[model samples]
Target: MSRPPRILDGGTGTGLQEAGIAIAEPWLTSAALRDEAGVAALLGVHTGFLRSGSDVLTANTFRTNTRALARMGVAEADRPGYVRRAVDCAVAARAAAGTPHALVAASVAPVEDCYTPSLTPDDDALRREHRWMAGVLADSETDLVLVETQCTRREAVIAVEAAVERGLTAWVSFVVTGAAQLPDGDSLREAARACVEAGAAAVSANCFPHAAVPRALDQLGGLGAAVGVYPNLEDRAALDEWEHSAHSLPPALTPEAFAGLARRWSAEYELAFVGGCCGTGPAHIGALAGLPVGAAS
Candidate 1:
């Protein structure tokens, strides 16, 4: 029988620090542009994951959009360079891995800050940011553009449109409510339908509780495209508080424990891809390697 689909690793920011980088504010991807050494440090973490047997390496451009940068005092003129640096960092990481092949993904975050769908920006703003990010990813050698943590239907569809316009394959992964539903409280069945209709090459639920993941997958069953999953292992209450406070310190999850959960879910769904979010790191992903992918006891 064929081997199971691989597990993708999670957030690179903290992993970069653990891999040894002096990051003052990890939230801004533009920090890489300001300090080449810092950028290199982050890229090194990507290499570490690749070396650790991860099949995918997501570029560290999550939250590098102009809107988020402006909040960090970055000027409009520097946005393009910021975006470019994000891609270059990933490229450098891939090269350092010495691997013959790996899927380098450009991570496109929610147009509006996640967990605050009411803050969803206007279409003009969303389109401009999405198009700019997608265009940059398109120009680079990225294998895929993964738009993640979408909190609303509108933002997810717009991201798909941006990717399609740029002739890139898009993956839309949403952040769902703790109740095992999409942010809008819609069923995943409905969410999957909408994502496929909007041109997503894959559909997933990311940055959610581990317990909720299998339910989310069940709700999304039967979408024609590949079904992926990357659940977070943090305490649900801690995540809610962090979202409310806009804090940067991520919660933690033991790799061994999360791996068991991932293995069980992966077996049941034969998931196309799986990984951790937020608190997940290399250890978590490493534990996922070689796990059975379909119909576990």
Candidate 2:
């Protein structure tokens, strides 16, 4: 692990909200692609992360898939347009950042709410939905597809399979429960292995509570694959919804403090990736980059 870690960007939707985008649920990133101003905002966020030293810029397609946008009454035929727009925005951002090395990633979010395990659909449905999303993403210029905030092993496997089937590099990240296990109480180690077996190139976690990261690193380490993390900055009782409450949560972990935590994991796990999630902004990434380089200790 002599190489420096790849500094992935922080949260996109949460970052967008912090940037003053009036985002409504269901449609999510789709609503942001309807105009030039909105597209500029998306590009601005990506460039901000790049300026902060991010090596990868995840596209704002976290909620642009047919299954998610369907909840907002977006027609099936129009979903591809939204996905394309989201990817294009991130691509534009990388171009504008003038960092030829920055890579764009198409994000694949859970078909159901990430926190509610009971709401996870059947395997067939998960396969179909994930494949549909991955198909569109693979056709784009994105360098990879990240299935982030996954809660169940079934869904992780399904998502990974879809991305691999499309010949795209996949990363499957799980959202753990308070007990540091998958939402269904399954071992995170097992989940990571399952995803890897399904062709995921990386096993990681994102949108996890800040405190759960230690346990996540313990599990992600020794998995024989690239490990990474991008955790929320505060402790929340549930992940049912991503509440945009960073401004009010004063005295919470500052960017420097978050960077220290990332430094710890990067040292211990030799993390392949590190960044922020909910409540994390470019400042967090800047602080993280200031730390010493990572090693697979």
Candidate 3:
């Protein structure tokens, strides 16, 4: 019998924004590390997701890497402290929610923007920076490293390798432009295969539209390693708008509607896990947790 799908928590950055935290660059959600109020809001976000029945709570380390921090004018000496704080907040949130058994996955975003693969750094820089990020996560004792929203196959493979080299479990996820393609037009199959070979414990498609999950699964399903998806509940236009605006697009699907799509994906693909991305919240996750596993018609 197939195992039930594990529920990963919904969007962290968006959750922070909804909690009245301003989430703009060059710091993004990582700015939360700078103030007690922001940290408390982050803890509340994680605790809300856990209370909604998520099995994995991703730490808000998505922009705490040295390169990103440097752009934000954070001194190099203080960067690792930010990473540790991100991890500590997640661990503390898990404790606050009374769920010691739940796992904490550290966010490992691409060194550059997730949507612009052309901006990816050279191999040497990619390897060096990812190694530093993974080492810090390992040092902070994260349960796993989630190398997510990777747009280029090369960076994804290197990030996964760095995490695995540190003896940490790695799950690599891509930002796809089409059903079977990464943003740079590389085959999703090829990228997924490369990361898996590089020692990623799982592979996934993330930050795509909810309407695209069926086609995304067509590319991800049947890979020997565990496969999953966490799609945003917004269309292409709205996502693009949100990239330049302070406000996020309202979710196109209600909690029940979003859960319906997740139910189909889980039942049809036997996904290892299912969750939400942008434009999703604890209610969306709670709906996923309530789904019964079975084959979809």
Clashes found in each candidate (C-alpha, N, C closer than 3 A): 1, 0, 0
Comparing 2 with 3 on TM-score, the higher-scoring candidate is 3
Q: What ranking of all candidate models by TM-score puts the best one first?
A: 3, 2, 1
After superposing candidate 3, which stretches have Cα over 4 Å from the reference?
A: 235-242, 291-297
Against the true structure, what is each candidate's TM-score?
A: 0.88, 0.91, 0.94
lDDT of 2 by residue, 1-297 (tens): 688788889767666676677666645555667778888777888888887778888988888767777887778898898889988888888888787888888888888778788899999898888888888887899999988988889888998999999899998888886567887888999999988888999989887677778888888877678999887765454424445442323224777788888888888889888887766677778778783333100
Error of 1 at 177 (Å): 1.7
Query: Which candidate, 1 or 3, has the higher TM-score?
Result: 3
Candidate 1's displacement at residue 41, Å, is 1.7
Model 1 RMSD, rounded to 1 decimal: 4.3
Judging by lDDT, tell me the better candidate of 1 and 3.
Answer: 3
Instruction: List, residue by residue over 262-297, the lDDT tens digit for candidate 1.
Output: 778777887778888766666667667743332111
lDDT per model vs. reference? 0.74, 0.79, 0.85
How well does candidate 2 score on lDDT at residue 158? 91
lDDT ranking, best first: 3, 2, 1
**How far in Å is the alpha carbon of 114 misplaced in model 3?**
0.3
Evaluated at residue 269, the lDDT of candidate 1 is 83
Expressed as tens digits, the lDDT of each residue in 1-297 for candidate 3 is: 178888899888788888877778787888788999999999999998898888899999998889999998989899999999999999998999888989999999999999888899999999999999988888896999999999999999999999999999999899886454788888898899999999998999998767777887888766678999998775446345225445555777888888888888888888888898887788888877783322110
